[model samples]
Target: MTPALSPAEVTINVVGALFAIPIVFGIFIKAPKLVVFGFIGILFCFSDSTWGQLETDANIYSRGVGMFYFSLLNLILMVAGVAALLKRLANPQGPQLAPPMAKYLAAFVFLLLGHVVVGLMQGIELDVILGYSGIFNVLNMMVFMYLVIMAFESEKDTQRLLLMIIALATLRAIFGAVRFFLFDGDTANPYRNFEGLDIKIFYFDINDNFVASLGAFCAAWLLTTPGVKLGWFKRGLLIAFLVLEVAAVALSFRRTSLIGLGLMFLFLFLRLPGTRKFMFSIVAAGLLAAVASVFYEHRLQFASEDDMLSSLIYDIAPSRGIKDGRFYELYAAAQSMDGNWLFGRGTWGTFSGDRERLSYHGDDFSFVHSGFGHVLLKTGIVGLLLFCGLLAAYVGFYMRHRNSLAGYARLLGDAGFAGFLFWVPTLLVGTPIIEFRTMMMLGLVLAMPFIAVGIRNYQVRAYQYDPRYAVA
Candidate 1:
């Protein structure tokens, strides 16, 4: 029998249900903004269990209960998505259908389903296959994206979505900062060692880095982008939020995030109109100087034998290249893909041969450190091609349509494009593709360009129909 809940737990559950009922009703009513906000908020707030972590929960009765609830949330979103789609189809005046790039994404989803069939033919157990196939969560995110496109009625809806993301992301950054500075009641040496690895647990999940990076880029875009007219007070608040987000990324101590930040700036520099480029450069340099001064002050106060700055510098340095275990793991995964390079070893595939060193939790080799390597290991060159093709399609679509946008739409388009660029380094070096939270965040970023275009087109059409509907 399952254990009974305590009185406090019961009360908490009742309160949660009360709130959830109304939220579900709103979703059923085709509230796109509500659904998008709730979805993104949950992804930022919750952590998903990895396969290795699931192995450790074998003795717990409620081990997978969180995921069960998450599935129900996805189901609700899907039902509402279908309804929204039908409603739009029935009304010719509704928001336009999915953009052209969606077909490429659909093809990628089909390829993932084919991988599942291949997994079954390779004799992998159903449970193992389901557990290892992170692509399912990716599909869920895509559905949510479709719902976003369908349900958002105007450019204001997209603007509000961006605002909600910025607000939530800022809160997350603040929370992470508090945890890093005060969680252990230590002013210095705010890291804990698990086994031999020293990890600074800023938040409950590694995906917080994605949130911080996205928020930082968006804040910077709002603050620096030309034609994005903001009051001095709003600009001041954005500047403060941007600082917090940059600090949060640094405190998280993820090298991939630092690289992603650099790439984002590079993308912004190259994509911005020539007239705005100089302004952006000035703002970017000032922000960097501010962050450096803040960190330098903190380092001075917390300088110790085992200081945080030294550890961060050491981690960022390239001296640990060949000595890193992930390098060996990547090598092992590459060697395992020797014979099955065409279609891959399927979804539930594990690295073959002596992978004792690469194994997590002993004898488990289903997950790898490198996202590209993991894709190659499981789906082979063809799946890799499909994945790359989808990314390329988004880039092409964004470039082709970005010029048509103006004002806030254009600001969001540039920010979204830069945010997506930020993920490139993470996808190549980090295991984001297999991580549910990271993939959901990726889906959101991937949908932004399309959303921006939709907002632009909607406004253009509305203005064409009515003189009063002209964009401000």
Candidate 2:
């Protein structure tokens, strides 16, 4: 694995990558208008920030200046790319209207707009924040997904993306494993607790676990693509790598991630026709996974995790806030919205310091992070319509195009869709109300399906009028 880059290198990357993205987007060079407008929309995500958590010494300008350069530009390039896409779509050729894909895109757009409306009700000004964030991260994810399709143009592109994903994931596993090896001794160690662990390994420290996050997600997605492409020796290497990754994630004990991974495989099976075989494979895989988990549990001497099945099964509370507070959060947010529920409380409330925790002991209001709760809080009833419709639409699209969609479409529509569908797990473990990194990841994965649709839209128009190119 490549050694982690130094801070200087990271800075160099942020600079080089930030500037090059626009050119890489190719909208200005080839398809200017679509690229330009799309970029303009994406800029909101990069707006400067004034506050954050866990700063040893806080500086308002730090947040502002940091994003001003990076996120701001990120927004610009993304919009430009989108514009380029629109320009390309002005004419292209292919089977574009797979019903499922159409529904996913349209519905998400609705949810996005609806979320902005929800914020308006509470009188918070997050329309811009959520707007920009939704546009950039979500859309960019799809770009990569479509790129998967584009890779079909060249086998090399396909290998590059897939390899990059694996390499990055492996790198993350290395970091996480080392961190665990260092910190594994403490079971209930506060330093090892989720709060501290987040600060210690990735987010708050010099070595943030940013790669670890993507690593886990990517590794989990790869689990869905299990197969035999290697000889026995190489197969042994693959087993070691999988074990390395699984160990890395297990080391973190990011339970939601586990949930995310578990559901992902489930979706892979259900979405595919080979449900029975998949189940058996998972069962076998589960045994291996179980043995690994046992080794780690013994290694750390950590207490076993609460029984998720039982709590979910019996509808019991495992922890005060952890158990069933999500249900109430969902309920309260909806109830407060009343008629406004249709369009939403407004986007601002979603990000605003609006929703306080029910705990009277000086607890603060925060996002429930349940996809459903977040929808109601951000968009109200109508937003729910869009959100629910969006999920249904994508799942439907997978049903229609799983086989027909080629190359990246297959990867993005199938695996990417499966990744987004894991939001169900997010509801229970409930991420931080403050927009955890994973939300952006989820948004990005969800966004890819739309990208495919948009690409196909252009492909069709480009070739639609060609008499000789009619669908054979």
Candidate 3:
């Protein structure tokens, strides 16, 4: 058995992310081509991998890298995007999504420099320059910002992105269903998980959380608007998708993601004004309660003697709450934190080169509970501060353009904010933050709605007011 990348998976990751580059660039500069690619990228994400699992130890099926993995595709896309950047030089004139944030972009650069300087002064080695992990994070951020820039190029481009996101969400839901019925939750094999590829194409591929997170993101988008494009077949698929995706989330047992998504939608339902939000909230809440009931019933049937949740519900049911059962795990993680409080060991991640010595999350682990924690582990307090500043810039810029798009813009903006805040549980979990797929997807989706703002302004000559800021 092979693992990770099937041929189609390779195409989706490579081609899909590559096209999203245009969506990013569109947010900054107008590029119709990016919209086409963005659709492709979104479609590719739906083509889950199957048949690439190889037996490592016991049930741990590991496979060689597949072509469709996001990281590998992004690398190829990066090269191509850069090459296209050359031709773009001729067009010289384009609109940017967040021109003012350029100031902050400068700030980010300065801060990175400062971190390096301080590290050197304090005799810290910057091996991140040579390490694949560090390099991946840096490049991933570039992809995030660039796609937002792509969307700013035009409103049509923004709409293109919206369509792509909606499509990806829909497809993911479909694939989730096909896999569930076809594989019977037997995600033990790659084919069982990814239904799009031949059973032979995929290697041990796992993207359960990736699917769930996006499912949440999509659900947020769909429920946010009135006329979200949903035909009966699509809507039915989405319904099925939601059920399977929610199941996947349960199966993943990704407590952090579930809690974060819950809080995010919670914020939206609470913060927004009017009946639409209110009614949607009621429906969503009721549906969620039902899902929770079923999930718990399932848990009861398969109750483990050593199950953590079971221990919490029964052993510490009265007073200890859920905290007592998992105190030791977190305490172990915190011990490492206290020792490396300041300049966290970024490269010294939980899922370092050693697979056997990893925590429950396995090889992909980063060991910092939250994304912020991951940042802390990587660059310490300094990195966290700089990273938050960059996010603030992203949020502020989106707010400025919110009115230019639909009500969905407001929802999308909140999603972006929530996505960032969503990492809080992870901070508590203190898991490794190297999950590259989530970052890329979050960047692309968040930027899509905001890029619409820039695109709208670009088309109607609204940007003409700022002659100096026009893409030159």
Candidate 4:
């Protein structure tokens, strides 16, 4: 028999159910668009391991309760997505439902589906193929992206969505700060030791740094982007939020967050005009010199017993040498693809070469620390190439249409593109593809440039018809 819930669990469940009432009602009322907005906003506020009032310390799929809640959310999102898509198709005057990158996305989806059949042919159980391989999460994200693209139609709608994400991310940052400093959780050692590596545990989940990085990038871009007018008080609030978000990321001690912030800075720098670039280059040179001096002063203290650059290269570039289990896992995964290099070992596949060094999630060895490695292991070269094509299409679409956007829409495109760049490094070294929360956020980010361009185009067409409506 199953165990009964305690009073605390009961209260948690009650509050969760009450909170979900609006979403359920919105769906029932055939307002899937509104529900999609709410769902995405809620996703920004929580993490993958967060379900109802309980937060697990590991992957949510490993726990029965976590999986139940995860599956429930997935079902709701799928239903809402279908309703929203149908609603769009039923309206003759609705904005264009297909994004410019539709063909690339469609091809990628087909590849994923084809691999599903391959997994079945390889005798992998259906549940294992879907759950362990993370195929369901990836497909669900694609559906959510479609819902976002369909639901948000106007510049105001997209702007509101961005503000909602920023606001929720700020709240999460505040919550994480309080939990780390004021709550009873570990302050000195805030990370959970996972397979010899330290994964930071804060607030409700391990991916707080990623959330903080996103908010920081968005806030920073909005504040710095030229022609974005705001009152002093509003600017002050935004600046404060940016500071808090950056602090949260720094406190979390995640290198991925720091790298993401650095990449955003580079993107912003490259976006500057020639005059500003020349002026900023001098200051940047001085900053680089100062940083180099500090590194030189501490040259002998690095773990690699070498200079700063060598230490960094040794840590990040697995091709340099395999010093730890993390890099070894990648090497082992590569070796596992020897026989099935063309189509891969399918989902639920395992790399037995490094079984002793790698940690298994439950009884399955399908999970990998690297997203690209995971894709290469499960779907092979074809899948990886298709995945790259999808990413390239997204970047190309942004570049092609960015100039048509103005004001807040332009900011959205620029920030969204920078955010996607921020995720590229994580995709290579981290398992973001398998994480539900990460995939949700990724889908939202990936849809943003399309959203910005779509609304801008709509305004252009409106202005052409009636001069009264100004193109924003």
Candidate 5:
């Protein structure tokens, strides 16, 4: 196990924070939105601190406080959000809310706060679950989402944000790939005793795979989009980046991420017209994968017979004797929501303690290892429906305006769609929404519709009709 934090490490952290404070302020001076982007990038690429403390529920008050205080990214966001809010207050004409967006946002906030109230009534400690805890973190997300929508005012702004995402993904992929080959002692078999690895390795293993896979899909989607005009060198660079991202995900040896990558590719391929050709290609790829699995089985620690297919089947299909696995977890979650199945036990409410009882290592009930289960456990059926409705609203909005959306905005929408779809299969055995990376992704997805609209039509019209509009 890793030792306690050394004094040197503490000094390094404090020094880093001191330097970041000025950098963050400077960014605010130029454009406040960049701070939000920086925060999202850090969340996506830097997961070590958060991963170390993911299972520490709100019940653990000391750890919870440490998690928030030590999380430099979250602290930056908190400061930036307050600054942006104050600026908005001083300048009332800063960013007007769109009616359509206001409706959805209202529903989401109402449900979130309503759940908190209900949870409080049920005797969940206010101090434990409220204020900077995982449960209250959605309030921060709402602020970030509002800033994203307000900042993304033009096609260029949208493109820049997508480029930032790609850049973050590229950095993670390069780091993961380099670490796998040169840094990791167990290059040949990295997953061996992986659970006991240090925070950095464990962090890179899970979160890096997500961004790598999702970024690859998004880059591929952009390359395929009609209006995207990538020169030969740029196209080559993107293709190389995609390959690196895919390689990183593959080498992580995380089956869920691998499944997600496969599903993303399948989803992208389905958009094309050549179904028969796609099917043949998939079969050929499967055969090649199986052969490669056998050839590299000893060196790569490939245990399953038919490569990943067998492993996927084994995971989905029930065992002969044991009535456990993801299926059992889902069942238990449903059964546990007996009386409070309507409003739920509230955010971060652990009414059933299913996670503690079912955890392989006695992890507390912070996460059920299932996105749907986590939502169901916290918000019940009603909250679950509202959450899904929020996602569905984004999907529906994207589909409606996909044709008219600017090229970069369309690509972002597509990426968000792919990311959401990738979560479907993984959700069975993964808790995505509660995780900051996926939560940030969800926020970005929710912001897509507004970003796609370019500056509000009224703003455009006002500028066209009156020179004073531009002066203002």
Candidate 6:
């Protein structure tokens, strides 16, 4: 049975609500676009484990504090969304929605709802699926994306959003750097649990790497792009942030994140616009290499005394092959196809019948680690196809419309492409699908094409009326 909250807990809950409600109101009323940046910021900066640990440390272990925080955040978002909708209804001049993107988002939401029904039919407890399957999280992401598109129609708004991303990523990088020195012992093993200030904030080092790397990629985009004015101070800040982000990835000591970061830079190198921009890329590469060299010894020691670059090559080289949980997860997914191949198992369902059972709201199941395996196991072949189809559609759409994007939209599209490139390969070894940042990255890619087109059309109409006025 669930326990009731104590007096202290009740006061905490009430205070949380009071603080959250005003913030939500202010966001919707004063600056709706800020909501997008705030959501991404919180997700990148904090995680469920952080929340859980805080609750445990507070002597309130009946439930996690993270859940309450998340619920409050969600409530804030919902209230903001409702206010936006109502304002639009009351005033016809409100921001317009993208019909095509809306349809796609709606279809995705329907698929998620269908999966919930499938989970229920498979005898998975509704609460268990709700808690773990992440349906709400996915829905919230979709809504956030839609709202971003509506709220951020101008190039200035997009630039502000990107700046917000860079600032948060800088914070993450500094946090990681501090933790690297303070918690260096935990760097010996990638999988071991290490409690530190940074780990408590993000739950894992890979996340720190992921967030910072993407921010660096976007910053690189803005810095290298043609006609974007930047004073020396701003340019120095961007370069410094990029270098720090690269250093943070090295400090993560996670081979997958480092590999992902490398691949993202390669994509950026190729996607850069022209000779001048490519020249800038050369300089950026040199700076990053210099930063990596500064930490070479630490990274080498972290990776079993092998040089960091050499270790990367040796690990990913085909001769190393697949081991660890990757092989086990793939084998488990393949072996689970006997009885229920169509809808293999519900959320929290697993193939490991022999494994010891752990209780989650009175339900027990094993977890598939790989993203592909998770989809195949939880929703089966049909659901896997749907998920894959959505991804393919987004990729196809992005590729088709990539060249037409202008200004900040083009830069964002490049970042999205680089992110997708990095995330796709990591799925073989990790469950990128269940991750909030990965989904948000995909949301950006999915929404960017339409947002780009909208910006272009708006510019064209404005230019037709007044050619002397510049449009961005």
How far out, in Å, is residue 61 in model 1? 16
Which number leads on lDDT?
4
Residue 302's lDDT within candidate 6 is 46
- Candidate 1, 340-435: lDDT as tens digits: 998777777777545465445266677677677777787788877767777787788888988888876776777778778778877776677666
* Candidate 5 positional error at 8, Å: 12
> What stretches of model 5 exceed 4 Å from their correct place?
1-30, 49-64, 67-72, 82-101, 111-123, 131-134, 185-190, 194-205, 270-308, 318-322, 351-363, 455-472
lDDT for predicted candidate 1 compared with the true structure: 0.65
> What stretches of model 4 exceed 4 Å from their correct place?
1-30, 49-70, 184-207, 275-314, 317-325, 359-364
Better of 3 and 5 by lDDT: 5
How well is each residue in 332-360 modelled by candidate 2, as lDDT tens digits? 65556656656655544433222354542
- Each model's RMSD to truth, in Å? 5.7, 8.6, 8.3, 5.1, 6.2, 5.4
Give the whole-model CA lDDT for all candidates, comma-separated.
0.65, 0.45, 0.50, 0.66, 0.59, 0.61
lDDT of 5 by residue, 99-155 (tens): 345565566678776756766877776544453323344445556666677666665
For candidate 3, write residues 1-472 as lDDT tens digits. 2444556756665666667555554433345355436534643363233323343322211111333233334544455456446545765685444554555545545545655666566665665322334324444554555545553454444445545555665565456556655664434453333334222211122344444555565565564565677788877766666665565555433345556656666766665557578676886787566645554444433334545456324432435443343343333444556556565554434423223333334444444345665666556666667667766766676666655555444444555555555655554453323544445544554455455555455544644777665432
State in Å the error of residue 46, model 4: 1.5
- Misplaced by over 4 Å in model 1 are 1-26, 47-70, 77-96, 121-123, 185-191, 195-201, 271-279, 286-325, 353-356, 359-362
TM-score-based ranking = 4, 1, 6, 5, 3, 2
Best by TM-score: 4
After the best TM-score superposition of candidate 5, give how far the Cα of residue 39 lies from its true spot, in angstroms: 1.1
TM-score, one value per model: 0.79, 0.62, 0.64, 0.81, 0.75, 0.76
* TM-score, prediction 6: 0.76
Backbone clashes in model 5, listed as residue pairs: none
Question: For model 1, which pairs clash?
Answer: none
